[model samples]
Target chain A: MSVIIFADQFQGKVKKSALEAVQYGAQIAQQLGVPAVAVAVGEIDGAELSALGQYGATKVLHVADARLNEPEAGAVTKIVAEAVAKENGAVIVFAHNFAGRSIAPQLSARLKAGFVAGAIGLPDTSAGFVVKKNVFSGKAFANVSITTGKKIVSVMPNTFSLNPGGGSASVEAFAAGLGDADFKIKTVKVETVSGEVPLTEAEIVVSGGRGLKGPEHWGIVEDLAHALGAATACSRPVADSGWRPHHEHVGQTGFTVRPNLYIAIGISGAIQHLAGVNGSKTIVVINKDAEAPFFKAADYGIVGDAFEVVPKLTEAVKKYKGN
Target chain B: MKILVCISKTPDTTAKIAFTDNNTKFSEAGVQFIINPYDEWYALVRALELKEAQGATVHLITVGGADTEAVIRKALALGGDEAFRVNSDSQDSFFIASQIAEIAKQEQYDIIFTGKETIDYNGSSVGGMVAELLGLPFVSIASKLDVNGGTATLKREIEGGEEVVEVSLPLVLSAQKGMAEARIPNMRGIMAARTKPLKVVEPAAAETLTSIVSFELPPAKAGVKMIPADQVEELARLLHEEAKVI
Candidate 1:
């Protein structure tokens, strides 16, 4: 038996989340006393596949199908299933991102394997295979046990720290007999956000809310985020008012983030907003309203006008960084 | 055209989360339930818009016990033609998907719509499972959708940006924000919803692969440390030295 990790890639580069998955799968393999094999599909570089070994993947299964450049869930499921069958995989690991969320469920249904999406920690095999995951939009945690013999788990991004050690993995080409039917969903166009850390993957995030007054005042938020080398986010109302794009909205009905550090500026902490960001390791709140609910949930709070405090905070961060 | 939209009830976003039965089950006491926003706002509303534009039938489906009828009726009031309640209390994602897939297979819906994920479990598993069970193509987290002829064009969020995809009819889509605007039930619609058909059906034979062993709330914060507004640099120092996160 082996643990199989889906080494998800975009434009030939492996994602940070994929490396996390590999490390997670390797830990599971250690628990089971089995090898962790990473399966890569589409147009990925051979050197990049070999580098997965540093994350504890013992071997890499490469399916060099250029068509997979745009991941069609159905087609990718078939390829992973084939890899699992060949390797006698007992557990399948994926990063619970957009691609994993789309593909893992189909794979679970196709294999009749028990799946736990958005898993936050390693499974407890001491008794049974119980995986811990956030539920209620991070308001609570659920310890879900997968009873099926074959198991699938999609680890939430940023849940685990990356620990790359010294090693090398042997890459082997695997052929998945896929047909046109497997590629039914056609990708007509692709638009990638360039030169910025994606919110979901950002280690540190700086966010603003309606208190910023308007889109023009967004520079202060962006300035702090830039100083911290973090991604920028906003509250729902700010996005609703078109002060920021919908994708930057970090709240309920938007992206859920668990960054190492999250700074909320001028945002009243609504429950819906907290649901998405409460999981951050450290929360910093800055608002003139000391009674803003966000202050109650914050680790460090500054009761001041955001227009005045944010620019100063940005300068402090830059000064701290010796810039 | 016939469309099947799946909706589920969830605790209001503000509802305090607590567990009963040795932390194995969610406590329903003092908790108000509403139609999951993603389903009601995006999936159901988008389906109603499609129905209004193309003169199609919109049917709502849910997998829950009798208490879910209120939410189902609310969905019907938002312009669904009929509704179905698969009589089961199972929280298992696969079991729920199987129940919906059985109904869709028998009814032969041209399109299946579901929320990207429920607010309670936050498991976005059912739509894909249902699609796989019926051997249909699935597109998830669709932000925008346009249908013409027998094909549908959709835009879905990728990691960094978005990708536009095209799929034929008889597919499943899990809707997210930007799909449609949320609608409220008018007085007339509310009155009409009372007389709408809500068919209760038994669940099909499906195995529940996962069970919740326990539940736990996050550790409470040790109260906020207030810093003087003028000493913003002190806050940065604490973040760097104390929090060590920077």
Candidate 2:
């Protein structure tokens, strides 16, 4: 009966991806001749949920349960699935994060809906609910049609731009009436990493590779990233060689990302690495090698040593930030 | 402890993607298919490690036609105790997940695993679907896993960092990197695998969820332009003027 949006929350605050999802869901709801409603699991302020109308939501459904706040994918999926059935929603939009990826497919199965991931842009309502998604590791695009009765799609992080209008949402409490049977799994503990932004959810990202030489030289990249309010990442070779931690690896064998601005320092663009990062909106490459393959894929390329260029770039960023 | 790791065969990472035949089917002509790299690392390696440590049975399960058997055999040669081919092409994540769930429901498996996602479609789904259908606990992207008696200790990777979690036995996990280094099969492992049992089963139903319409390659890029290395000021000016991305 409506387009349902799962508004992603981080530490009880709505993330940028959630706003984008809300905007997307609202737009789709308008196209489908239905209302745009928002769904939130765990503890979120009713006022904030009501405020999501600025991002295009008309109404918000709140399932403020303490168990929903943790890393239990099953619990979230159950609540969302039951809510979707109750709301008579035929389409559900989500931000393709860890929780979304873990929960969406299962929900699709339960609802018998067509599911898609890594989606970008608006759905082609002109043609039977077709969606554009990246395939072949961001090297290609696909226009897939969902003919099933219901549909689910997880929009890739940082892919869609959120354009909010002046409006407020009506928040109402929703009860999926879930119990212990809904829980196939439980999280005993949750370990959160502070200080650094999540790479997948970051708007801007600055990445370094083995070319940085040592950990001491990381200050340059860190400084630039901090000034830009960006997350940091590294190449697989750098992670393998111990120049950076394995989580920093971004490639086919590592994490796939799609950030608005991706800056690469001292990293030669390998095809495998490009497969992971090709989804970035604007790529900036900083390296001394003119023949670096990364330059071909970059919107901007600088042929200079990262050691020299990074410091200068960081200084410029600091000046730009007015500090 | 018998471990069954499901592996999906997909197009290589660098292949040109397109659709053919009225935009209803994926065009795989001239494309190379490999065992999903994540499956090779996470699921395959973990199964081999369990086989080595506990001297248990390790089986390779895949849902595909005859062509996929090669990769399943490769997994068998590597360390699998047996192989099972679902004997049909996977339709959607639900169709595939339901088939796997059916098989799991009929049998007893101490541990079930898979790669986090396939690179070709990047559909990081299915595993969670299977887990839900079978009513099993699942940990996504576990970089480390240990099973002692009936409990499991998993080091799962979060966005910015990692988390150490513990769960009961007979759980499911989507293995990511740092789980175990993938191993190549030696002559002994290969020879012993040739005689191992391989059972092919038919899926119970057809796909009703999703259908691929068409695919297209990414837009072509202009040639790479080089700036003088010593002209740092010029580079800054160009970033502001020509690129306008700074």
Candidate 3:
């Protein structure tokens, strides 16, 4: 039996989170005295497939199917289950992102496996297969033990580091049954968020809240994000008000993120909003109110008007990068 | 059209989460509970909109004990026609999905709806598992959904974009934000909800594959360091030299 990981890709390039998943699965395979294999669907470069060995994958399975360019969760689930069965996989690993979330549980049910989603750490195999996961919107943690014969883990993004080593993974072609019935969900349109790093994979995130006042005053936030090479996020209220698109919202009721540096400007840091970002390694809060609740949770605080502070910070970041 | 919405009772978002019995159980001393926000704000509200627009009947279901009836009643006040309490104290997602699938199979509902994930457990496992068990298509994290005749149109959030997809009827959808606005129960709706039917059914026998061994709270943050408002450059230098994040 082996540890099987789903190395997700977009536009033929392997995603960073998927590399993390591969490394995590490789570690699990080491613990189980087995090999780690990665399965990927859609168009991927031959060099990229061989590079999987750098992440400890012994072999890579590719299904170069154009039908899966925009994968339906059901079809992907079938394909992954097939790969798992083919490998006699004891543990299935996935990066707990959009694709993982859409497909993991269905595969778990199909395989009668116990699935642990949003797992923050590797499983403890000493006693049993116990995994730690975030609960209550990161307010609390739970240690879950999987008693099933088959196990599935969807690791939270950014929780595990990608470990690269030297080797070449052998690639093999697999038949992913991409029947026309699986494409029952017809895609009418795709609205892409162009020219910006995805919030989930960004190392730094600069977020704005209602304190930014209105959509017209968003230039400073954009400028700061661009200067720092960080993704832009907004509190739920800002998204609800249409100051930013809904996809930009990061909070308990929205997207949860765990970047290395999270800068919140004009955000009062409601508990709900903090729920989404408290996982950040370093949190910086910028608000006019010295008594804002966000200051309590922030690693650093600047009590000033964002209009005055953000532009100055952006300039300083630009200057620092120049040197 | 008949729509089945799955609602779970969760502690208020502001409620302090605590564990008891050696971290093996969630403490429930005086915590106030409500319908999970994602279910209330998106799934239930959207179902209510469909009910009003197309004369659809919206039914709510919860996999919990009698204590959750109050939260189920609140969902009815927000315009659900009826509710079912699958009497079970188990918190396993598979067991809950099995119960929900059994109900869906018997009822022959055209659509199954639920929140993207429950905030309490934060496990987005149920809806997909239920759809798999019932052999139906599942649309996840849908921000917008509309049904016309036999086809359902969905706008779901993907990694870096929104995907517009269409599927036939009898599908399952996990609703997220932008699906519908949160609805407040008016006095009339609340009074009408008092008389709504809430049926309690025994759950089907299903085994749980996983169990929570213990719980722990996240470590508290160190007190904040106050940087002078005028010294923005210093903050940038610290970010680069100390934090090494930027």
Candidate 4:
């Protein structure tokens, strides 16, 4: 029995989450006294696939299928299930990403295994294989125990740090049993949101709210984000008011993110918005109003007019970057 | 077309989280349970749109006990044609997926929809498991969806940009925002929902993969710090020297 990890790929590039998933899967396998095997679907080059050794993948099962490039969860479920059966994986680990969240459960059902999503840490195998996860929209955490033979878990992104220095491993090509019907989900068109890093995956995030006055002022925020190499976000009201795209909204009703540093400008911290960003390692709130709730949760707060403060902040960031 | 939208009754976004029974069960003593907002946008609203366009029946399903009936009824009022309850609190995703799978097997739904993830448990698993169990297709976190001629068009987000996908009928999609705006039920819809049919079915007993041992609230924020409004530039200096975030 081995631990199988679905290392997600995008246009042949391995995502950071996939590397973290492998690192985690390797740890779990060590705890369970089993070998860790990884599989990558979609466009993956053999040479790049062999480099999975850095994350403790003993073997990489590369499935170069065009159908896997799209975001159809069912097709991935079948492919992952096939790999698990071939490798006799007692446990399967997937990054709790948009794709993993949808596909892990399906694979678990096909394997009749127990499943857990949003795992935060490694299992405590002192007793049963138990995993901890954030629940209640990241307001609370729950520890879970799995008593079944086969277990599936979707590890939360950025929860575990990726480990390097596992050295290069061997790669193998595999032909999993699948058909056109298995590729049931078809792609018609993918609407692209241009020139912004995905908030969920960004190491740093720069967000603004109505306090910025209008969409015209967005340039300053964007400039600061550019210098910081950070993603951009807006408050729900900002999105609702058409000041920013809905994809940039960060709140309970919007995108949840956990970055290494989250800088909020001219935004009051509402509980809903906090639910989405409370996971950030450090929070800095820059707002004119001292009564703003976001200040309480912030690791640092600057009470000032954003129009004045943001420009200065942008200059400082640019200076720091020596750009 | 027959569509099944699964929902979970969760605490409203503003509710103060607390636990009871030695920090075991979530305290419902004061918290208000609202329809997960993602479901309201992705599942319920989208279902209503489909119902309007295709003249199809939409059913609401949940895997909770009788207490969740009101929430289920609320879905009916919003737009669902009927409701079903699996009559068990399957906390584990594997167990809940099985219950949903069993229901899908019996109902044979053409399309299954759910929120990208619930606000409470945040387990984005059921729809995918149901799709797999039924041997149907699954697409998740779809921000855009269109149905035509037994095929579906969807726009899903990834780490960098978004990916557009197409799939045949008999599939599942976990909806995110931007799919559709959530609609509130009108008086007529509310009145009609009162008389709508609600079916309660027992769940198939199965061994669970995971069991919750305890629950803990996130550590609370200490308090707000104050800085003068004019010292905005100083804040920038502190961000680098103090926070070391820059």
lDDT of 3 by residue, A153-227 (tens): 998998876768997899999897678887667778878788888888888899999999999999999999998
Q: Per-residue alpha-carbon lDDT of model 1 for A294-321, expressed as tens digits?
A: 9989999999999999888888888667
Clashing pairs in 2: A1-A88
* Residue pairs of candidate 3 with colliding backbone atoms: none
Q: Per-residue CA lDDT of candidate 1, range B1-246, in tens?
A: 999999999999889999999888899999999999999999999999999998899999999999999999999888999999999999999999999999998899989999999999999999999999999999999999889989999999988889999999989999998899888999999999999999999998999989999999999999899999999899989999999887
Best by DockQ: 1
Q: A246-265 in candidate 4: lDDT tens per residue?
A: 78888787877888889999
Off by over 4 Å in 4: A191-195, B222-238
> DockQ for each of the predicted structures, in order?
0.85, 0.60, 0.82, 0.67
The C-alpha stretches of model 1 lying farther than 4 A from their native spots are: none
TM-score per candidate, chains pooled:
0.99, 0.94, 0.98, 0.95
lDDT-superior candidate, 3 or 4: 3
Q: Which stretches of candidate 2 lie over 4 Å from their true place?
A: B14-30, B223-225, B233-246
Interface C-alpha RMSD, model 1: 1.0
Tell me, by TM-score, which candidate is best: 1
Model 3 ranges with Cα > 4 A deviation:
none
Model 2, range B43-90, lDDT digits (tens) per residue? 888878877887778777899999998888888888888888898886
Give native contacts recovered, as a fraction, per prediction.
Answer: 0.84, 0.61, 0.79, 0.79
Task: After the best TM-score superposition of candidate 1, give how far the Cα of residue A23 lies from its true spot, in angstroms.
Answer: 0.6
Residue-level lDDT of model 2, residues A18-87, one tens digit each, is: 7888888888899888988888878888877888999889898888887776647777777778768778
